[model samples]
Target: MPSFSHDPLSPKDAADVVIVGVAARGLAAAARRAGLRALVLDLFGDDDTRELALAAIPLRRIGAFAIDPADLYEQLAIHAGPDIPVVLGTGFEHQPEVVERLAARFRLVGNGPPTLAWTKEPLMLARLLHNLGIPHPQVFADHAPAGMRTLEKRIGGSGGWHVKPASESRGWGWYLQEELQGRTVSALFLGNGHKARLLAFSEQWCEPSEDAPYRYGGAAGPIRLDPSIEASIASALDAVVNAAGIVGLASADLMLTGDGWSLIEINPRPGASLDVFDHEPLPPLLRLHFEACRGELPDLALLTPEAAGMVRGAGVFYAPFSFEMRLDPLPDWVADRPPQGTRIETGEPICTLFAAGRDVREVRDTLARRRDQLWRDLSMASRKAAE
Candidate 1:
């Protein structure tokens, strides 16, 4: 039987929480900040993750993009003690069945399989948005709409990497949607199945490469929004929470276009923006998630001026070429650090760089400078080795 322990500070001998994801560093960090002992399972058991987690295990990768579900289940079953509640992150978004299977075996926190299926289904979400009178991009399942610029996206795909031009033919599990050009914004919220409270609003950016055009680059904010715009988004979210029965931490991706704000998709989990929105004085997000899941909503008054005004940004620094990762005593600014002597292929993400400041522009600038400097340092090291 699954176990539920309200005490986050359980003995270090056993895990109080187990976090599973494609990259679980952020979630593990949040759990640690909340005074919980977390066991992390992900594809990259990065250096920071190991430091934060009681135990860290790498999930098996299938090809360059997919996680092997069987491997994930086997690892979880081996490490997750009976009754230990599991918190899922990025990897299982594409495999709801796997999540369902895991939930059947272990105590799964956050949203259940039904909630995930309801929110992740493109057609269902589009219809819900339409019925709510919210602006949303038109989605077509299994076929492209005639004579309109559309993008092909995979079901259960997160991080925007799975999106491509509709002109290209792909295998099954693909759907087409009208492309919108505008500012990409994400709203992070805490919900209790009936209502949701906004935690932060962030501007999302993508880094397009030859292979992954819509690759998630980074995010910046807790940005101030026009009162009217914020109201509209809040109203949309309220409708969504009631409609989908979303509980705990969730994010809504939308585009502010010439027409208006159009809903993109909903991430029913602790998303990438957790790092940008996480601040002190307020309880850690993972704690808030746990509280909200138990039907308690966090107090919005806890959002202090410092927490709301402070802007944080993170950018993924991709390897410019195939090189071995070698940063001894890794810089404090860099995270998701691969083990030394690990061979990284060209275009693969190297590490994530983070910066925080009072001004969003300054934070973004600092992140950019840091990213460039790290790449230059890597290039110089490579050249020296060759010489």
Candidate 2:
């Protein structure tokens, strides 16, 4: 049996809180530190991160948890816990039936009526953003936009899924016209309707894998967002937040153009880059999470982008190590000096290198240099082993 801690902090009162989809492990951890009785529930049971999950809850008062959403009813039936607050951290596609079944049982933050309605179709997200007046890339469906380059994208994809989903769903995929001419901006939104607040905003770049032509190479950080483009981006998303009645975190992808911004799509949950946002100590985003969990607005606002200049540069360096379609282990030299937020995955792409710098060039150069070093080390080691 797993050891349980019964310290005073555990949320003995089940009604106080709960969390779903263990992927939002960091947020859960923060909530626990704040004295919320949080527990993680996911389809996959405890693994190496379960300890991390437990730490996010009160020591002794940690509420009961279920392993999978499918097992939720069973788990709750057995524990007879309170109707705690639930935070959704899974992807847009993973929602659907799972959310519908549990909506009545628990209070789901950031999700309200119509939140999942528009997601049933592919281009609905883009349409919603456009209708809401947010600027984004020119969208093409069934045909390409006139006089511009276009890239295909899937309806409900995130991170690795971003490219793969588009490739597999070629015929039904939506096209993003390059001619729209705007920076690729992503926003993390919190709250409902007109009251929604923009938590974090940054640019994103998409890279394709060389070996797996359709597979995404992962994202690089700190895509430069022109200060002028914030208004267009904000206007577009506020409409969707109003329409959908979403309250938690919603990520919007937009393209800024001379004429206006075009809507790319919206992600209604915590995104992969959220960890990058956390490193900035932005108050609005942090305050939003706490406010949602506690049901009160934090008078504190996020630090201005200028104030966050101390840790100015940040980016994720995707592992490029591949051999005949298989991901290889990290070479000693590269693994030896792993950056602070570096993450390595087995049986997948090698790892993701996350680093920060004082400026864009500094950050980019640091990542480029580290990447080269990792490459050199790998080459030298291979030769030595071969000899």
Candidate 3:
């Protein structure tokens, strides 16, 4: 077993920075490319992230720091020291009180208080976009009438939530929308102050599902846009940044509706397809994130024609036969090692697969193949165990 220690701050340490969630692709890759000696910390022991960290940095210098998000800063401060550069990779809502308390102690890099505050609700973000005249899907947090079809979403969540077809339900707020057959769009933004730039725009298809409205089955490469549409998106992005005074990673989900486009709410943090930028090179956004951390503004650049996409990476969980009584070891394949930065779970998200290709269709096809293969492997392993 790996020995765990709380004393992170040693004078002999060579790492210039400590990346909190190296399990995340963007964070790990950024730290790696920056050539910063990085130590990755996460609750579940991740061999993939550990291997990637070593590969990205020097094997001798790279280190792995595994701890729950709840114990993050204190552990780092105790062992890694107070001056280590820290970037948060966990959700903003997971431990709000702890984040607030540790705000002043570490050299933390992230969005401001308001940006974090606004993202707590879909309706609040929609109101901001609507008031600014940014084009977005018509969204209402209030109950839909008798005959309209709408998508109920968790205001504070992403990556799908329990989506019940509701003529009427309350408490869990959702993004109510009429089902439209177009494209689901996401554009990445980076900026400081009121001025911002569009980094990339990816057009995706939410796999048609009568059962899973909130779940996206797969996605495709970044859609190369006609100049006119790109311009409209750029103008709208600039307007949003100006209005919000936001300057980190922001993504807009839009739909190509008939002759015009409808805007979905903006995700204040990096979204599911952040790795798309990695497929094609877009260093400006990555640079901007670093700049923001340094309290410096980065130059804005227009997005090029390069495209990239992602298929929905799904997971299968094995629930205990009953309740908490069956505390067995996480099964073999579920506990199997994944590629670097591939997320894993013991009971919930067992495994995930990502694929990229020349176009959206190819990418979608590739993802489907990978997903199917993973399920087959897991099913076979399970059946063999039973036998």
lDDT per residue for candidate 3 within 84-177, as digits (tens), equals: 6655654443234444655667666655556655544556667777787877655556677667776666555455434545644465444465
Best to worst by TM-score, what's the order?
1, 3, 2
Off by over 4 Å in 1: 1-13, 167-171, 301-309, 383-387
lDDT of model 1 at position 167: 48
lDDT for each residue of candidate 1 in 1-387, tens digit (9 for 90 to 100): 113375464333478899988899999899988889898888888878998888788889998756798898788767886588889988777778988898899888888888887788888888888998989898887666567788889888987788888844375677788888998988999889999898778888888988678989899887766678888888889889888899899999989886478889999999888787766655789999998898898778424336565778888888879987655766798988888777889888898889988777788889988888888777776666666
Error of 3 at 81 (Å): 4.3
lDDT: worst 10-residue window of model 3: 318-327
Q: What is the C-alpha RMSD of each candidate to the true structure, in Å?
A: 4.1, 7.3, 7.1
Positional deviation of residue 386's Cα in model 2 after best superposition, in angstroms: 16
Clashing pairs in 1: 2-83, 3-83
Poorly placed runs, candidate 3 (over 4 Å): 1-13, 21-26, 54-69, 73-82, 93-99, 138-142, 145-147, 162-164, 172-181, 205-212, 293-347, 381-387
Which portions of model 2 show Cα errors greater than 4 Å? 1-17, 29-37, 42-48, 55-82, 92-94, 137-150, 160-182, 211-224, 258-260, 279-281, 284-287, 290-303, 312-352, 368-387
The TM-score values for the models, in the order shown, are 0.93, 0.68, 0.73
lDDT (Cα, tens digit) per residue for candidate 2, span 1-387? 124565444433442456665344544544544555456654323232244354232111112222355455565444325456666665434346667766766666656436765632446655765576654455555556444566555445455333422212256533343344555656666655445566556646554554333343223343445556665455555667667655566676666666566666666666554645655455434346646434444443433556666433323344454312121355422211232223333223333345566654565566567667765654455445546
Q: What is the lDDT of every predicted structure here?
A: 0.82, 0.50, 0.53
Clashes of each: 2, 19, 14
User: Largest TM-score belongs to which candidate?
Assistant: 1
